[model samples]
Target: MLDGIPPLLTALASGADASIPDLAREVPEEEWPRLLEIVRRHGLTPLLGEAVLPHGDTCPPTVQDALRTHRDYAMLWHRIQMNDLALILEALGGASIPHLLMKGTALGFMVYRHPWLRLVGDTDLLVPADRVEEAHELALGLGFKVTEEWADAHHLPALQRESNPPIELHHQSLYVPTPEPGYTLVPVDFSLLDAEAGTVDAGGFEARVPSARDALLQLSCNFGSHMEESIARPLRWVRDYAELLGRGRVRWSEVEERIDFIAPDLRTTVLMSLALARPFIGDSYEPALLEAIDGLPNPYARLTRVVSPRDMVHEWTTSPRRAWHVLSCLMGPWRATKWSLNKLLVSREHITRQTGLSGDALCMRVYPIAFALHAIYHLRRADRSRGE
Candidate 1:
């Protein structure tokens, strides 16, 4: 279980009535840096400002300055993102393309008290799968260039405008490629989200956001998949869920039903996400939802003593390897075998793109060389771990 969670974070998540002044007074000046790092790591810098800036005098001058800087930077970026979004929305609307905002961009408007309080690192806009290429064309027409690699199965390559955040035109909400060619383990049902979507006004234009039920499920799927895949823990997701649930906006029954109907395989993932956010939600969670979570099959039950934010933070921070190892075990041997086979038999186009090399002979030779290098990488990591 995670231990030594800074009290500052707990107070921050403790709702509107939390005594930020008392918490700030109790915090040692020396501890500010560590707390700030934790907050920053979780994408909570702007949120920290919201909670602490009102009681700024209680904090150290340096910490106050840092918080202000983070808040100002986030606010500025947020405005740029909104302006860029407005233009993109206009372009898409003109083309008669249907789009729904997803992830942080959507959650900021739907859940947060103030949109800027939710820091959007990038904009995620979902378009119908069939229309994604057309949407991609529209994005390019708007002078946004593909600043990255070729489009993946889930979305077009991230498009960026000079001096602004990147935009991802998504055909799928989430995609987890499996070792099997032409198969993805997790592909969100766009129709469900699209059908139940609601519109929110972004200054001058209207943008679609997933309904509360869909929002919670999408967040759960994203959060659960990340943890299971050993992706970095971002506390902002917990905050988003906390805000939605704390305000009594979510319909737990609908969310649970949707999960069961569309993706029963993700039941555990959804539970893990909810379990992690449950403490932060205080008394807001529905009793039936808690009961359902308790009743769900928990494969990771043995791995974690407590499924709370503190423990999650501890697990990720103190020993990322342990978290990875547990997730690897949960992923099972079949997935590992499939992944290895997939790597060995990578597409010719991918090989050419990656190595700038062509021909069957050269690509065949790359197979052995790639395997050796991969083996060496893992071997070195194992040796380092043993030595430590």
Candidate 2:
């Protein structure tokens, strides 16, 4: 599975004619559409258009034109995003709320060659934990409505308004729970990050982004968490890490010291991210940094080394492999086993919610039968769809 990067992806990412004369030429004519779909799904269409549009006559006119159209749409989408960001930042500023931009939106401004080149799904803003509720209310006052919520989530339920991107109002850095007892990946201290954060000129406005070190930590942890959530694209995340490293803002020595002092458990998450991105990054990063990452003990060495980034993408797209990948992400076999058990023992309220059946004494008695019938129905429906 660790064979190598996919050729089409290499062509798209590196834009090297030596890799392929035409990106479309790398795949069969019939497969070109599927390839384009993969790129779009993986959040590479903006870059794809930019890469292939310049090499006229190399790719099919239809391919080039389609990519160019998507590229133009991405640019237009970016304008909408920027408008929303400005409005959100203005609201926060007017209220005197200390807010720092996080994730893709911030990286777009601070690291990417062009803000639109980095595809963003939503705007992530981190406010002080105490002010998060106030900010959430502010978002509501500004017309955004809550779309999703989870009790233990790091961010408040996601908020969105019509004609604008969703907003994840975070109170703290996200954390990943490891198999190690009572130990989760180290989370960034919002206060420390806030103090060290620097402002970027976001088109007539000043918005704060996390310090380089904190930003790297956040990306690494996010990679781990999103993998478990089945919403991550290896190519997208690896590109993020590679781009960030290319900026040369990080101090490896200081990052190492911070990891060691604050939480060594975070080392694996950071190492895994860099290690995966290393192949794509080529000689951009320090050899010493690679050496240090290699020297550190990696419990997932076999799993990480054996699975290529392309394999990661496949694991998400293909079944059985998808199940296996999710199991691996449980951190350990014992944890995975425990999780399976806990899932089977879900509470009565969960059953009530799922079946919309009353939780009365009679319903409680019949709940097992009802749940089994529901499961059977779901499995049959899935099988029918698959067969179709």
Q: TM-score: which candidate is best?
A: 1
Q: After superposition, how far is residue 358 of candidate 1 from its true place, in Å?
A: 19
User: Model 1, range 1-388, lDDT digits (tens) per residue?
Assistant: 1246766676565454267667777889998998887776566777777877888677899999998888887778788888889888999989888889988779989988778777665688999888888988888988999875756567788888995778889888743322344235566667767888999988778999998877776677667545532233446676787777777787677777877777766666666667767666646788887886677554544333334466565555334344335444545544433333333334556767888875544435564564444344444423322201
Model 2 per-residue lDDT tens digits across residues 11-89: 4443333445454555566767777767765677777666666667656677888888877877777787778778878
The segments of candidate 2 whose C-alpha lies over 4 angstroms from its true place after superposition are 1-5, 11-31, 179-187, 261-263, 296-298, 317-320, 329-334, 337-349, 352-388
Q: Give candidate 1's error at residue 55 in angstroms.
A: 1.8
Highest lDDT scorer: 1
Candidate 1 yields a Cα-based lDDT of 0.68
TM-scores of the models, in the order given: 0.80, 0.79
The TM-score, computed over Cα atoms with residue i paired to residue i, of candidate 1 is: 0.80
Question: In model 1, where do residues sit more than 4 Å from their true spots?
Answer: 14-17, 174-191, 228-231, 298-300, 303-308, 315-320, 332-388
- Taken over the whole model, the C-alpha lDDT of each candidate is 0.68, 0.65
Measured over all alpha carbons after superposition, the RMSD of each candidate to the real structure, in angstroms, is 6.8, 6.5
